[model samples]
Target: MKIVKVFLVLSVLLSITGCSPLVNNNPTKVETSSNGSYKALLFVNGMELQSVGHTANESELVVGEFIGAVNEKVDIEIRPSDELTSNYLEEGTEIYSVEGNTKIVLAKKENGDYEVFE
Candidate 1:
């Protein structure tokens, strides 16, 4: 009986230790509006990250690849804007137009992560 009790206690302990807590690794997703002219994602440094429905300017930048299940190189563009549309939101993120600011960045990768620079 004692041996059976020990085994039961050991099994219970093992079960408790074997289960791992669910990990929450939800990354923040930033997206640009359908119209790039109206809404564009920008870095805190004022670099355009993603835009659509707009003419390409002379300046375009190739930034680091997006950190995700699939590694994809992201093209960050630089557009001229008169003033910032919003601030005091996410740090290290900015928008150029008063309409909206599309910004990118920030993630804690289990193995690797996307690196965004000024």
Candidate 2:
């Protein structure tokens, strides 16, 4: 359930923000629990395929800077959904792909494409 909500929110964000690559020192959200309200601030290390992200309560929100979430470059891509993304590759329907050096947040669209939230 939480995953679904996060995926949806990511989709909306990708549409609004052209999936630009991200860099270190960016403000990312931390974990918190609450009601129906859901949000995500995730970071993926493009070099190591490691990532960190969490949801926050509608009110209790915390902000901090990431030291080195992404190693070198930061970018967001709008690739075809069929393209193998990290975890999604195993299930062929997952929304995230973090197996490679470049870690990216993905949301599966109705058209079978992905909205890469970098």
Candidate 3:
């Protein structure tokens, strides 16, 4: 009986330690573009796809393979004005726009040099 109690106590301890606590049950906060400039090409499946933020205004975007190539052409538009459009950028990644003044979070990965899920 003592051995069984010890085993059960160990099992309970293991169960308690094995699980992670849940936090931040709230929805994610939306990050707004500073100066209406878009950042980071939406890299999905290893390609630069198009996306837009809701608050994005006449905001400009940089589209290129390398960071330097963005301005090799013209600025791209983040159309439709909706955060859903940019859900692909993920959260926490830093991005710069065509003019290079404003910075925003990638918030997701659409494509680019990084590997992604289909």
Candidate 4:
């Protein structure tokens, strides 16, 4: 009947509108360190990760591993190579090493951005 056709058309239109992807208007801000000479170590779920070193100009560490979920937290420590080795004190966990640089700490924000520290 005519009523059935009208209901069906409305349902289809509603479904199509509801299927649109979400848009985030307020984007998250990225944090960067001021020190030009610093080193960072990235850790995910307490496991050290091998990542490309981020310079003072770069705000975020470039990670090769795939982060499965959004807003996943990562811990970063900026310290001397010797101190890190001494503190961690674990074999085969030393992923990257930098010499003659100050250490800094970084944490992942809830919005999936790195919060840089001095």
Candidate 5:
């Protein structure tokens, strides 16, 4: 009887603990513009993630490491690409500029929503 009760309690505890978010060791992927003149750089937990740009119907840049826990923050910086000297006005290129840089900070909430801060 005592062993049965202990087993039930342990099962409940395991289920509760499993409700938390899981950590991802891999980096996040982001879509970019095919003809855009900017690239986005991402930092998570103070580490620069490995990212690459690929060309499909459009261009995409995979950036950032996934946030491992709630309240963890990710920072992104958009800069002008060296391939293009001048900033191009496009859908994804709006974030890039030569006069000033664009940066955003995002924090993961318990509800799985990301709070964005400039």
Candidate 6:
């Protein structure tokens, strides 16, 4: 019985380890926007892709900078509308406008598609 239990545990561990998480797992670097008012970060494969400005906004917001990965680049514009939340890749192009100041992250899947997190 003890051996069977150990085998089950081992099997579960192996399964979990083999499975990949949905987001990138790399370390990220941050850079402030050229205007010096906002910051942005770029993430690659679940890793900290890049860093940008503070995650705060007031009555108005504007597009800051563009987030890129390796050779790929995505437009990181600030939304004037407070309803914007985070950006995501819907069909082909990125859907920049979001709902609110929800923490947003970007990830590229194995299928070569972009995904946005909030």
RMSD of each: 15.5, 22.1, 13.6, 14.9, 16.6, 15.3
- Worst lDDT 10-window in candidate 5: 90-99
What would the per-residue lDDT of candidate 2 be over residues 29-106, giving only the tens digit for each residue?
222336542223233332222222322222223322222222222222211121232321222333444234233444
lDDT of 1 by residue, 5-114 (tens): 99999999888767744322222333334555233333334443333322212123233333222122223222322122121112323222211212433222233332
lDDT score for residue 25 of model 2 = 28
Q: Residue 16: error of model 6 in Å?
A: 1.1
Go through the candidates in order and give the clash count of each.
4, 8, 10, 3, 0, 31
Which structure among the candidates has the greatest lDDT? 6
Best by TM-score: 3
* Model 6 regions more than 4 Å off: 22-24, 28-118
lDDT of 5 by residue, 1-118 (tens): 9999999999998997777555322234233457753334433334332223322112222223343332222223233222211122222121211112134333333443333322
lDDT of each: 0.33, 0.35, 0.36, 0.36, 0.34, 0.38
lDDT of 2: 0.35
lDDT of 4 at 111: 46
* Residue-wise C-alpha lDDT for candidate 3, range 2-88, written one tens digit per residue: 999999999998887677354323223323367775442343223344444332223333332323212122223332233223333
Q: Give the TM-score of candidate 2.
A: 0.21
Better of 5 and 6 by lDDT: 6
How far residue 118's Cα lies from its native spot in candidate 3, in Å, is: 23
Candidate 6 lDDT tens digits, 1-118 = 9999999999998888778563334323223356764333333334332323222142243332334333333344432111222222222323222244334543344464334433
Which of 4 and 6 is the better model by TM-score?
Answer: 4
Cα lDDT of candidate 5 equals 0.34
Please give the lDDT score at residue 59 for candidate 2: 20
lDDT of 6 at 41: 32
* Candidate 1 displacement at residue 7 in angstroms: 0.1
